[model samples]
Target: MADSVRSPRERYREQVRDEVKRHAWEQIASAGVTALSLNAIAKEMGMSGPALYRYFASRDELITALIRDAYRSLADTVRAAAEGGTTAVALAGVIRGWALQDPHRYLLIYGTPVPGYHAPEDITAISDELLAVLLVVCADPAAEDQKSPFDVLLGAKRGWVAKVLASPRTVHRALSFWTRVQGVLSLELAGHFAPMGIDPGLLLAEEVAEL
Candidate 1:
């Protein structure tokens, strides 16, 4: 038991921090972010509130951490999809897959904005990375005739902002795709479709086809 009493390596703190964040994520999944409470989380962990404060200076810090993680996860998902294939179609499928797996988490990033809520710089940076992946997937030199609103908006440069101004149609397609997909996802997550007797998968496929 003496060895158990000994502290783990300082590096372990990061692991502990992740564990806390994972629990926090679970909480967010079950309930909206507005429902998150540190005391409740501590109780869920079978610890006192003070224990979590050691890692998160305040509730805001914990929320910021979660937002950052959400962005990173999205960036990784898009990056993996881009690396896996060409076709904007496939990339759009990847985005839908990620959103379906955890709609609540996706909304945490793109859902209705809260009043007075400001995201940290890293969140926007990660979001840009995700968009960059989309730009790469959508860019088609051979299919210049198929340019969308985004292509015109994005113009010639395909980096960050260039992707924004290339083709207006492509930009509209991207935004519409995102909003439609999220609309379906948000509705499903909120159980709004149960009464309508419509299959979300069908709606998702149709939206993807439009993209």
Candidate 2:
């Protein structure tokens, strides 16, 4: 399983896949995910459309690969922060930093849903990892146990809520953290705040600290 023991053919396959993904990302950035075309990527890579299909059978497959990579990178980043004893505000900053580092990556997952493309279950599991980390840092025994109406509603309806083994209040806090942070990032990335000249980072800090 060591890198030194991998066969040349395996290495070549991985290299090709990586190269194809690079081209796909370029296409996603230039146009949009809905406009991503395997044939276009193939032409860019100097390969026939059929040849590219061998690497990624369809556009959805290529998209799934990219989404998986993006989610994995984020899950790892947040998990690392949680393990380092990050506070709620610090963790919000971590998420904001990751999103700012790559707006396209952030928007790809959170900006808008790709029509006719449903994320596979494994992708859901990776996202669950993100929520799990949020729950860890959002836990506060000293806080009041008061639950709002939405918290009760989320607990009753959201299947993942009970599985995470946290109270509805904790779940509510985590969800609020996610939504507020993402709201700031979405607006900032879309140039909504540029004219206002407000700092998104400070705005994000205030939002998380208030939680």
For TM-score, the strongest prediction is: 2
User: Per-residue CA lDDT of candidate 2, range 18-58, in tens?
Assistant: 99999878888999999999888888889999998888899
Residue 210 of model 2, lDDT score:
90
Candidate 1 regions exceeding 4 Å error are 1-8, 114-116, 140-169
* C-alpha lDDT values of all predictions: 0.72, 0.89
Cα deviation of 163 in candidate 1 (Å)? 7.4
Q: What is the TM-score of each candidate against the true structure?
A: 0.75, 0.95
Tell me how many residue pairs clash in candidate 2. Answer: 0
Candidate 1 lDDT tens digits, 72-181: 88889878777876565566567667877877778888787644568888778788776666555555455667765555665655575453554544554555666776
| lDDT score for candidate 2 against the true structure | 0.89
